[model samples]
Target: MEDPAQRRVDYGDRSFDEADLAACPLEQFQRWYSAAVDSGEPEPNAMTLATAGPDGPSARTVLLKGVDARGFVLYTNQRSRKARAIAHEPRVALLLVWHGTHRQVAVRGRAEVLPRAETEAYFASRPYGSRIGAWASEQSEPIASAAGLHEREAQLRRRFPDTGSPGDVPAPPHWGGYLVRAVEVEFWQGRTSRLHDRLVLLSRDGSPAALDDGAAWRLERRQP
Candidate 1:
C-alpha cells in the first residue's frame, strides 16, 4: 500500500494573518462555512466527529445540523457507537474540512444531549422519508441482509401510510441531538509553501463573551 502523505502536493496558494480574522472564532467559522457552501462543496455541513471509548478513539462523519453560541449541534441514534462513546466521555472533537477552499476548522469541547423536546422538534421537521428511515433502521446494529432492511422499511411504510402527516412519524427515543460546547477552536487556512495560517481561540469557562476585551479567549498563531 502506498502512503498517501508521501505524495506531496504543495499548498502554496493563500495566506492568512491574525489581523484579518474575526474577533471571535465563531465568526471566522461562519465566514469559512459560508464560503464552503458557495463553492459548491458537497455536504458542506458534514464533519468528522471524534469520540473516545474504552478501546480508543472512534471517528465518523456526521452532518452538522445546527451551530450557535452554544456550540455545534449534530444528531445521531442514541444506540450508535458514537453515542455510546459520548455517554462514556462527554468531550468531543469536530473537524470540518473544505478542501475546495483549503480551509479547516478544528473544534474540541464537551457534548451534551439535547432535551427530548428539542429532539422531537428537529425530528418532526425532517423529510418524510428520513423520518421513516429513522424508524425502520436500527443504526449501528448488525443486519441480516439488504433484504432485511427493505423488509423493515416495508413494514414501516405499512404502519405509517401517510408520509406527509407528522402524526405518522414519531421521534425515535434512540435518536437525538448532541451539542458540543466548544472550549477550543482552531481555524486553519492553507497557504503557499505550507506556511499556512493557524489561529486558535481558547474559551474561558465555556463562554464566548470571554473572548471579548481579550479576556474571553487567548488568540495565538502557530507555525505551519
Candidate 2:
C-alpha cells in the first residue's frame, strides 16, 4: 500500500565535473547554500545532525546557527540527548537536502563545545523568555506534565523580571553552542536516467591544508 509518488527521489544521471567545484569546499558549500536560500526553501537552515550515542547512532533535525571554515555551529541545552551524545563522542555528520534543486550535502566532522563566554554572549542575545526557559527546563529529562514546565517557567520569570535589555538576561550554564570541524564534505546532484553525480572532499589528516592541495579530495561517481 505504498504510493510511488511518495517515494524518495533518486538522484541519478547528474553530471558533475570536479573541476567545476570551487577549490575550497567551504566556498562550494556557501554557493550551494545561497542557492537554496534564493530558491525560497522553507527553513533552509534546517539540517539533519547525526550523533553517536552509547546505545548506537541517532539523528535529529536542528537549525544551523552559523557556519565557517572551522565547522558549523548550533546552539542547544548542554543536558539534551544530542549534547550528551556529542560529549561522549565528538564525531558527527550533518546532511542538508534541497529537494527543489535535487541537491544534497553531507558533512562528517568532529564536534567541540564552544567557550563558556561565547555561549553566554549568544544566550544573552536571545529573548528574555528563552533565557528563562533555559533556566527552567531540564532538557531530556522526563517531565511530570506540561503544567509543571509552565510553573517552573513562571517561577523563573518572577525571580528575574525582564528589564528590557540584554544585561537583564543572563546565560544559563546549561546552554551553549557546539562547533563541528568537518573532515569530509560530499556534494550530490541529481541527474537524469538514474545517473547521479557525487563529489567528495576528504582530508587525509583532518587538516585544512589537505583541502588546499589539488590531490586532497578524491572525487568519484556513486551508483544511484
Task: Name the best candidate (by lDDT).
Answer: 1
lDDT of 2 at 39: 85
What is the per-residue lDDT of model 2 for residues 7-86, given as tens digits with 9 covering 90 to 100? 77655554677677887777888888998999888878899999998878999998888887677889989899999999
- What's the true lDDT of residue 62 in model 1? 94
- Could you give candidate 1's per-residue lDDT for residues 30-133 as a string of tens digits? 88999999999988999999999776899999999988767889998998889999999998999999988888999988899998998999898888888889
For every model in order, what is the number of clashing pairs? 3, 9
Kindly provide the TM-score of model 2 when superposed on the true structure, using C-alpha atoms.
0.87
Clashes of 1: 3
Per-candidate TM vs. native? 0.91, 0.87
The Cα local distance difference test for each model comes to: 0.85, 0.82
